[model samples]
Target: MSAPFQDKVCLITGAGSGIGRATAVKMASLGASLSLCDINYDNLSATAKQCASTPRHLDDVDVGSKQEVEKFIKDTIGKLGGIEFVFNCAGVNPTSIPLEETSDEYWDRLMNANLRGVFNITRGVIPHLKRGASIVNVSSISGIRGSAQQAVYCTTKFGLIGFSKCMALELGPKGIRTNVVAPGYIDTPTNAGIVKGGEAVTRMINGNALGRLGTPEEVADVVAFLFGEESRYMNGAVLEIDGGIKMSSTTSSGK
Candidate 1:
């Protein structure tokens, strides 16, 4: 039998690792042509090699650069015919530093990598996106709630939620869908060392109702749903895949 995404063309940013890599692999498994972009060439090539569908291209793009993002989109379209789906998953988390200690450079870096990166990619890809195409922005639980020492990161993510909603309203008329996936702490190479034998890990597990960190694959599942016809009616929505982390307060506070 043919795969659900057979012949579809997908563009994924930050596809070298974590949720981005997982989503790229998942989409490829369903037969979608992939355009993987990341700053890490090695990881991007690794992901491309693992994909079931051949990659149309792998780009080392710094999404914060509008020119680079536009170039990547153009390259993808040139190679894959057209873009049918886009996953804006590139982002960064600030170190656990007090607000006052956070430097201007830190804040700018976080915003540029997270919020501005998404904006750059979206603007570049919108014109080329086919009708019925889907765009999924990867936000975070920090965006939906307060997180210690993550003020800047949280701010960008919260902005992303709003950005995606407004884009959805504008794109919906064009038969394109825009939405967001807010993931909780997920196990990934970037966080693996930090999460190991750390107080932060303990706090993360205890804070979640499930008492565990989420996996990249788990978040990718939600992304796939958003991309497929199963979620055809879903637009301008922020689906939280945080194992009840956001809902925990309501249960514990019990009004």
Candidate 2:
């Protein structure tokens, strides 16, 4: 049997670690060529080597910058030939502090990395996508619902969903599909402190229906599906990899 993504060209950002690296690993095993980028050359190079035999190009790219994203896309097109699967997986975690204590720098940093980065990358890639292309933007459960201390992070994610929907509407006629994946409390390096084990952590872990944190590979599986023909009919959709955490969220109307 052939790999699901055999011969496809995939572009992934934030390929240094976490969800991005996991997706790159999975896609590489499935016979996809990759154009991967991240700010950290060491980590990105590590991911590149783990790809085994899959053809790929790696660069230290800051997706937050429009100029870098534009060059990255051009280089990808020149190297990979064309991009069929574009995964906007680069983003930063929000500072878990009250809005009152949040400084302007913190807010701008998150916005630049999360929101503007997505915009820059997506804008750069749109012209390269033709018929039968797929675009997946990574969001968070906080975007779908609310969080106590993640007001701005939620804002960027919510904006991503809207941005994806518009892309779907505008580009659907050209045979391009756009979608967003929302994950909840995935076990990544950034969340090491929370997943380390504690009372509050235990509460959050048990709060979800699964009573545990999710893995990056778990989310990558769904992304692979969306990137392939299995989801040919899916567009402008939001798929959550939260293990039922959002479903269990408290709501006055339903309860």
Candidate 3:
């Protein structure tokens, strides 16, 4: 059987690490050509080098900048002929702080990186997207429900979901599909130090039906599916990959 993504051009933001890095490698392994971007030039170069395909290009882009995102999208179309898949995965989660203590800088940083960044990139790529193309926005389970000290982060994730749904409705008739993958607490180097053994980690694990934190690769798998024809019927969908964490019945209120 032929590879699912053969000859397709995939554009991925945050391709330096975490879910973005995993998705890039996974798509490339399935025969897709890649255009990777991240603020970390060194890590982006590392990802480009690990790809199975030759002639891959890596760009250091601030996805929050409309001009930068538009330029990257145009350049990718110029080099690769067209864009078929877009994985909007750039995001940030600041150290947990109470809502009252969260500074203006903190809120702006999270909103710019997590929400506006997705908007910038997606809008730039919209006109260039090929018929039947797909876009997957990386959201979070926090978007679906509240979490202590995660107000700002959750706001961005929720905004992303709303954006994805609206885009899907607008683009669906034009043959472009848009959806979101909301992953729960996933294990990644970025969070390695912060998620160290603690009551918080224990609470997170026990809250999930699976009793485990998810893996980046697990989230990547759902992303890959959304990019493939197998999920062509799915649009405007917020597919949750949280190991049933959102469905847990436990409540802080003692019954």
Model 3, position 71, has a per-residue lDDT of: 85
Q: Candidate 2: deviation at residue 132, Å?
A: 0.2
User: Backbone collision count in every prediction?
Assistant: 0, 0, 0
Off by over 4 Å in 1: 192-196, 246-255
Error of 1 at 140 (Å): 0.6
Q: Mind giving the per-residue lDDT tens digits that candidate 2 earns over 1-255?
A: 468778789999988898999999999988899999998999999999899688898889988998988888998888879899999998887656779988899889878988898889888888888899999998887778876677877788888888899989998899999998888777777653354447645655665778777889998998998988889999999998876784554210000
Residue 145 of model 2: what lDDT? 85
Give TM-scores for every candidate, taking all chains together and pairing residue i with residue i: 0.92, 0.93, 0.92
Model 3 lDDT-worst window of ten: 246-255
Clashing pairs in 3: none
Q: Write the residue-wise lDDT of candidate 1 on 1-255 in tens digits.
A: 457988889899989988889998889888889999998999888888888446568999999998999889888888888999999998775466779999999998988999999999999998888789999998877678866666777788889999999999999999999999987767776662244447756666676778887888998889999999999999999998867784543111000
CA RMSD per model (angstroms): 4.0, 3.8, 3.9
- Give residue 244's error in model 2 in angstroms: 1.1
